[model samples]
Target: MQSHARGHLVYAASGVLAVHTERGTSIVPANRVAWTPAGFTHYHRAHGDTDMRIVFLAPSIARLIPEHPAVFLASGLAREVLLALTGPRNHDPAAPDYSRSARSRLLRVLVDELREAHEQPLHLPEPRDDRLQAIARMLHERPADNATLAELGKTIGASTRTLSRLFRNELGMTFYEWRTQLRIYHALVLLADGHDTTQTAYACGWANPSSFIAAFTNIVGTTPGRYRTSRRTTARASQLPTVLKSPD
Candidate 1:
């Protein structure tokens, strides 16, 4: 993980990106954009054959954005603007170019678009307590585990009530709530890897496809089927390996 001198915006033109920082994790699918303010140590993991693009923001524009990392829904206009700014034309000397003034105007519009857009609940906050850390590690390894908080506590040496209070006080959510979020995060990665809904449901601990659909739609703002279809063009197995050359 590293930080930049200037804040920047990253867009996954295809596939998905997850931004990790000390605070938590933020999932950035194709329909969203992520902004990381200057000097926040973080790293990004590309999921599938991601075509990620980035645009650095000037300090003036950066201050208008949140100081911490955040995810925002990318409107059609916002997507177009981001592509235009980061597209090959900017690097290809023979291609048509944008003047400095024109670029500045585009940056202003981009920041304005984000301001008008609402923040997404895609972040899963990190916990600090040792007991909480132990619990998190176990579940991270087995999201499909259907064990209740009480059942999980038995293995971790903490009482159910203590664990419940820790989740609330330290993470600001209940055990089930955090697990649901964790499951959804894993579900996205699974889908990116070409898993069908039925497969993803069982793999992520959902009893059946229907239940998984309801929870996925409620959190991701779209059905798993639709999300899968949208990613089909970008994540073909044949082209996924190139992403490893540079995981940024």
Candidate 2:
């Protein structure tokens, strides 16, 4: 993981990007934008064919956003602004170089749009307790694991009640909720990798595709089939500090 002096927003033009931090993990799919605040230690992993775009925010602008990492719905206007500020369209033969003042104005607009956009629940908060960590590792390694909290606790040498309390205190969610999110994250990667809905459903531990479909749509706002076939909108790169480096 690496820390940056400037806060940055990343957009996945296609595929999915997972932003891992000490706090937990944030999933960035095509329709969402992810923010990592300045000085946060983070690393990224790309799933499938990804066209990840990144824009760094200046302190003046960064202060307007939440101090913690966040995932926001990328509204139509926000998406366009991001693309105009960073995509190939950012350059113009008529304008030659896009001026700093103009780009800054665009960024202000982008921030305004983002402020109006709903923050999403794409974050999976990390667990710090030893028992919770053990449980988390177990689920992460095999999202297909259908073990109950009691069963998981048994393996970790923790009581189900104790583990339940720890999950609430440390991760701010129930075991089932956390597991569902973890499975969704994995399902997204599988789908991006060209796995069909049925395959992904089972791979992520769903007993049936219908169940997986419901859970996926609840979080992602779309069915897996449609989501896989959807086209990517143009957006993301920087140096006003709107630089586009190789995603890795």
Candidate 3:
């Protein structure tokens, strides 16, 4: 809990949330945008640990914005443009300034897309009961296990019927849906770690690569290879090893 209020824009690049406040709680997920108005005290509980970008706009820059704490769904173009604008070169003066001349024009167009973006709800609900927490933890611990709802219910000491209702009422999804989201979210971490999709698929409990790819593509808006390539391509500051030349 915070004593003083503050205004900020928080983007969850990956992961999910269970946010609580007087404005009410929300479930948030990847590629989603949230702008908290000045003095809104809220505590965010993450569904899974995630990487995020936060731009705290002062009153001067923020006064122009109409909504005080608006949440929006980020479009594909906006997401790509943001990634590019915030790429490695932007942080390093020694790196070729991609902001020069013609490059500056391209950047302008990308920023415009972000300005017109709209919010979409990505939050996943959760149960207040501790028993459900234990079940959720088990699911998180073995994302690839593909535990059937019946199996999970048995382990958690709740009947499958009761668990199904609990999942919908408290978690806002059927057991299977929640599991799928968990798998896709975890896959992004593996991909970011430079693991190939095939290996990631198996490691994450996917029976095969195709299934994992489908799940990842559906939620992440891109394939694992494409995402990895984007990472490496934008990794402009990578140090190279020097070797002495022996022969021409």
Candidate 4:
């Protein structure tokens, strides 16, 4: 958990990463990256054995990015540049004279590529009001809890109408909409942890697999099974050691 004066791009070379900020939480997998603007208080948590890579940008370059935190797809060129910039040798503090000119050029290219990358629908916005916060916490702690807003309001001592208004005004979404987003965010973590679709659906408060699949696909751009499979594939590939053949 940390924030810095410098804005940075965060990438996960092998596993899933989640970036939590005031605006929302963004999930980064192998195919995507997250950008945290300068002076923003944010924290990251790795979902698995993650190979996280970060590139700090100067204020001038950082200003070109979104002021709020965002998640972007890692383009082919961006991925290559990221690997080059974060590679072991590039971080050698004593090797100042090593390809200084080329490295600077690569950094510019990386920023340009990221600027054009499309934002993913991975952000889970937070609600600021105390009433909304309490509701969010309850849903977060017990994702499987299927209590309706009216039912929840009884426990929290707020009218269903008041809670609904707060959700829209603070979070810019209805109670149901916000709850679905929360469930999807939790679903991502459960799926990454290797839960099957049916189990994840039930755990995330979906009444059935079909409904869950529809919601997950609409938000995540893929089915739960596909998302899990992709994560597993990336993890296994990252673990494989490089092999070199003897000279013939």
* TM-score, cand. 2: 0.91
In candidate 1, list every pair of residues with a backbone clash: none
Give the runs in model 1 whose Cα sits over 4 Å from its true position. 233-248
Model 4 / residue 128 / CA error / Å: 1.4
Cα lDDT of candidate 4 equals 0.79
In candidate 2, stretches whose alpha carbon ends up further than 4 angstroms from where it belongs are 89-95, 231-248
Looking at model 4, the pairs that clash are none
**Error of model 4, residue 215, in angstroms:** 1.6
Report the poorest 10 consecutive residues by lDDT, candidate 4: 239-248
The whole-model lDDT of each prediction reads: 0.83, 0.84, 0.59, 0.79
Q: Give the per-residue lDDT of model 2 (tens digit) for 1-248.
A: 89888999998766789999999999988767999998899999999877777888888998998899999988878876776766554544564555788888888988998888878889999988888888889888999999999999889898999998988888888889999999999988888788999999999999999999999999988899888877332322222223373322
In model 4, state the lDDT of residue 114: 79
Score residue 49 of candidate 3 by CA lDDT: 40
Per-residue lDDT tens digits of candidate 1, residues 134-224? 8788878998999999888889889999999999999899999999988998898888888899999999999999999999999888999
TM-scores for every candidate against the unseen true structure: 0.91, 0.91, 0.60, 0.87
Candidate 3 Cα outliers beyond 4 Å, as residue runs: 1-4, 11-52, 57-125, 235-248
